[model samples]
Target: MSTATAGFPLLTVTAALPAVGAVATAAVPAARRTAAKWLALLVSLGTLALAATVLLRFQPGGDRYQLTESHAWIADFGVRYELGVDGIGAALIGLTALLVPFVIGAAWHDADPAEGDAPTGRRWRPTQGFFALILAVEAMVVISFAATDVFLFYIFFEAMLIPMYFLIGGFGDRAHSAGEEEGAKQRSYAAVKFLLYNLAGGLIMLAAVVGLYVVTADQLGEGTFSLQAITEARASGELDMATGTERLLFLGFFFAFAVKAPLWPLHTWLPNAMGEATAPVAVLITAVVDKVGTFAMLRFCLGLFPGASGWATPVVIGLALVSILYGALLAVGQRDIKRLIAYASISHFGFIVLGIFAMTSQGQGGATLYMVFHGISTAALMLVAGFLISRRGSRLIADYGGVQKAAPVLAGTFLVGGLATLSLPGLAPFISEFLVLVGTFSRYPVAGIVATAGIILAALYVLLLYQRTMTGPLEKEEIKRLPDLRARELAVVAPLIAFLIFLGVFPKPLTDVVNPAVEHTLSDVRKTDPKPEHPVADKGWFDYTPGGDHE
Candidate 1:
């Protein structure tokens, strides 16, 4: 599931070029905002091209991690500037590159006052700055995805908050607050919640990362803090820990990812953030940013603590099921479309968690694919919802009616996205959801059956939202004059629609790349534990349905 092609520093160029654009955009003058936006767009496009090249050149069935690069960054602290992509990371990095430019394009017209309008004050400057911040965030997120060294990953992981903080607090929806001034305050509150929760979780993870380093160093005598090295040392039985210490380390990592995954109970911050943040910012958060949690869980938790992960599967599955039912019920009662989507995301994340903890190859592979699919689906849903908000100046579902009669393209696109969210057949969500369900059924049939009802609830909520907003008579004066998606708006949404269908009907290409990594990971977990017998075939990958057969 890795590529071993030379002559292409594809990963670095794709991850860092957008950062360069962010810096360059900051240097541009207010009068030349168009130039800054174009520069950012071009940089994003270049990165996308690089990602595509990586995809094209990748050897899908070869190594487990490919296009790998490593160097010493902070040797005194045992941190290396190491980066690589297994199938999961590569797919996510590609998703980031694809989505960021669309996010920029989504807000490009809004970044400054539209043509023929003169900005009156600091508004234009801050708006433009938000675009730059988004680009910077995209850069940091891509780096996080590519990072393999624990310390380097943590740095990028936490550093992502700054740009996003400003993006929401400075340039989010003004309608959410009591007034324009209160809008900023609301955003600030959400930002603080996001920062505090993530920071607290991160500090815990930092202790665990350090704890891991110490354990490796103490046990192996000359260990470095490379993910590969730590993993190898653990596999070889060089580093050992008591059960209690392993559990503590697991919680440290678990709390951080759970918060980001916004797993139930720990998910209070997400609704507030979605309620106040701009659509573009919300897209980044839901689609790209939140993936960091699951990504890290897959990379560190499952990779580093396989036995602990396996042992703790039931508790995790229980939480995931709770999130599934709870999030859906909450979504049904929500008046705000954005908040509704936020809750829906929590539900979907529960499914991902379920898949991961299923401890089956199909479940793991489906979880990985679901991350990418959800990113696209959620972005599409949020952006279209944003378009509705911008035109009508409200996010309340009651505020919209007969939008289909008024805006056919918006209605149609929203329906497509909504159907995808509900995991309608022939769409991208269906395939991944089926895989997760099928995978989980192999281990926890009862939980899987209960969780399947979430799909039905999702259908109901999405349909109800769509019918209330788009299909009814244009009830309000504001809804009467709403416009269909403009050319600029189409630019923002078209790619997401394309990808939703692309991944739906033709996911095999991606699954081929990912299966090898999933296989490798499962093999390592079973190797380290060697109990409860896993399905390890001579093909070197485990099949999900079979029980107690490690060949």
Candidate 2:
């Protein structure tokens, strides 16, 4: 899975361009807010082009790590400015880049007054700052995906919380039912809670990281945070750790990722953060930024501590099952539209983690594909929902009724997004969800059976939300005047919908890229898909002799 570094630094540039653009956008004059928005959009498009180039250059059958760039930074501390992309990293980088322009377009006028005509105490200038912060987050997330160095990844991994905090607090959703003062307090609280929870997780991971370096130093005669170096040493039998130390270190890393993954008990921060932030930023939270956690579970946790991951599988599977059922139940009960999506996301993350730990090629490949498709599908649904809320000025499901009667196009687009979320056939998520279940069933049948019920629950929430909002009688005056999506908004939702259908029908492009990486991960964890207890192929149409050698 390891490969020599290539001379070009495409991954570095892909990550850095967004950071540089954040600075440039923030520097724009206050009056030129539109210019700043345009600049941000352009920079995002350029980054997307670079991502596409990386994807094109990647060979499905090539080295497990491709387009690599490594250089020494803190030589004494064994930290290097190392960068590379496996298939999962490449695919996720594409997902992050793909979502940002749509986010920018969706929030184009969000910096305007919350009420069309209400004077309120404003704490900050949002115009340039809002867009800049998003670009900064995109930068950090991109690096987090591509960083092959554990310390390098953790730096950006924890750093993304800063911009996200401001996005939640300073530029909250304008459609709040609460008074401005109360809303501000809520946003501030959500921001603080989000930061504190993730920061605590990061601190735990920091200790694990230091422990890793210490272990490597003791056995290899030099400390290193390089993922490639450590993994190679273990493979070649140059470094080995006692069972107790590996398991403890693995817990430290896994705990941090689980919190960031926002599994079950640690997921409380998500609803508040998404509820308070603008819709695009909500998508950023679940769709773009939060992916780093699950990605890390595959790249760092399994890659570095395979034995510990294996030992902890039963406990991890239990937690994932809880998240799936728990998140789905809460989502079904949600009255607020944004919180519903947030809860639903927690459910989906559970499926991704389940697949990764299922330890079959289909499972891990599906997990990687789930990350990409979820981002696209969530962006479509959430952005369209944002547009609907902006027009009617409410996030409560009860506030909306018979939206299709007034704005059929908007309702229709929303319907498609919801259906995709429910994993309806011919949508991208269905394929990934199916593979996860099939893979999980092969090894852990009982866990797979319990997980399958989550789909039924997903159907209930998505359809119920659509029915209540789009199909009921046109009750309120505000709902009646809701206009269809504008050209700009259509531009965002249409392509996402198209990708959903295209990828759903033909996911081979993604699966092709993801399978090799999945294989490498399975090798790292020393796992293989379970053989069937009964073989159907052995007893074909007429060959049903009970005593025959079926093996």
Candidate 3:
């Protein structure tokens, strides 16, 4: 369907505002680093305001892509600077916009030298560059979510790695007990690994994109990377290809998203990246950027290649189950708080993938909602963990004890975050996680049952982390003296916690918004659940009686 151009270019403006801010912030003099922070905040808030406008203007049960803006950029290749958002994309853009300002605030003092220490390395330098990189990443993330052109999406998708790489490698928090040299080396290793993994995926996807373009040109007499165009072609049977070729193309895209989702076997880079990067950057990676992987899986992989998606479902679902249990098991064993959170996200992401691949309306809707809920809950965990680590000058669980005695408010917030992670009832994640399981059960009962074990593992890890860190007696004088959650820290976490509760209590709005887009996506895939073999008897509920006559 062609885009409706009735309203303002809201999506474009929302995506571009951050880039503008990044340029403005980067132009500020190094001596005026404080001004840069303010500028970054202002820009981020402005973007957030624009994103809010998009959300407000968004019609919940409306078109698949709303407020779209399409202009020819590469006429020969049928490329356009196409931008728009379905409800899901709009919500994610809003989430990205919402988190950027807080991340800026959270990282405000990160670049400052520690007390009684002269600035010694790039890590101790001013933070203006960090803020600029964040804004840039935000812009790319917004565009990546909103882009309707596959090539444009790939550009934004690959482009995001640059700033994130710098954030992890250059400004990573050093382990408190490690020397500067050791920490720096670790950070570099993590950054390079992250880059290499994503680049490998991107390269494979690029080849797939080119192949898709060639196939489209051969069949339709034109090559295009427009998602709508390709989808239309596929629907019209003009984009037909051999089964092997189709599966290859689907695999190319799925492999990339799997790595980005950081699914089980491919998820090794995440813990290292999270363990090495600053908390704010880690928040961005885990909370916002990773959503792109699952989002693309639904949008591009399944949307473009339905038959291949169904063909690959069995293998994908098995891997997803492995991710769920394996990630949670690893999380249960982690001592580093950041790595624990990272592994938990892998487990959460496995649920998302399972839901998407389940090919049920409920599953896709839950997966989409899970993306937003995971963003909020994970941000809370990371921010709170960052606060604790900052005060204690350590990330090891063994380094903290009876922290609740010293910082009750902080401990309480952390516990709430932990509870959310474990999918406690009445929390946001529980709704989505439940929906995913129910949907998976309706289709793949065995995989669903196996994956449910991750919930027990989640509780084990989150509680263990809290118990060892917050519940014991205050033995270390240093631990006892740690300050409570400061105003800035509270400000960073309160909105996330409030969102978790608000969405938990009243998730209808988000689900309503997500359902239509998910339905549209599922319609494109054109897959349905297998029909039951037995006829149902006349009963209030589904009565599956063998040899029962139909009404």
Q: Candidate 1 lDDT, tens digit per residue, 310-413?
A: 77888999999999989998999999999999999999999999988877788888999899899999999999998888888778888788999889999999
**Model 1 lDDT vs. the true structure?**
0.83
**lDDT of model 1 at position 458:** 98
**Candidate achieving higher TM-score, 1 or 3:** 3
Residue 302 displacement (Å), model 2: 0.5
TM-score, cand. 1 vs. native: 0.93
What TM-score does each of the candidates earn? Answer: 0.93, 0.96, 0.96
The lDDT per prediction is 0.83, 0.90, 0.87
As a TM-score, model 2 comes out at 0.96
Clashes of each: 1, 0, 0
Give the backbone clash total of model 3: 0
- In model 2, the Cα lDDT at residue 63 comes to 86
**Model 3, stretches more than 4 Å misplaced?**
1-4, 116-124, 529-551
Q: Give the alpha carbon lDDT tens digit for every residue of 1-551 in model 3.
A: 33445656778878888998888888899788789989998999999999888788888766788888888998988778988788888888888888888888888888665564555433346567888899999999999999989999999999999999999998888554687778989999999999999999999999999998888898889888888888988898878878999999999999999999988799999999999998988999999888999999988998888889988988999889999998999999998999999999999999999999888877888898889999889999898999899888898998988999999999999999999999999999999999899778777777778989999999999999999999989999999799998898888889889989999999987887788888888788785543344444543443222212122
lDDT of 3 at 194: 97
**Top-down TM-score ranking:** 2, 3, 1
lDDT of 2 by residue, 9-86 (tens): 789899889999999999999889899999999999999999998888888788888888878999999999888888
Mark the regions of model 1 whose C-alpha exceeds 4 Å error after superposition: 1-8, 113-123, 527-551
lDDT of 3: 0.87
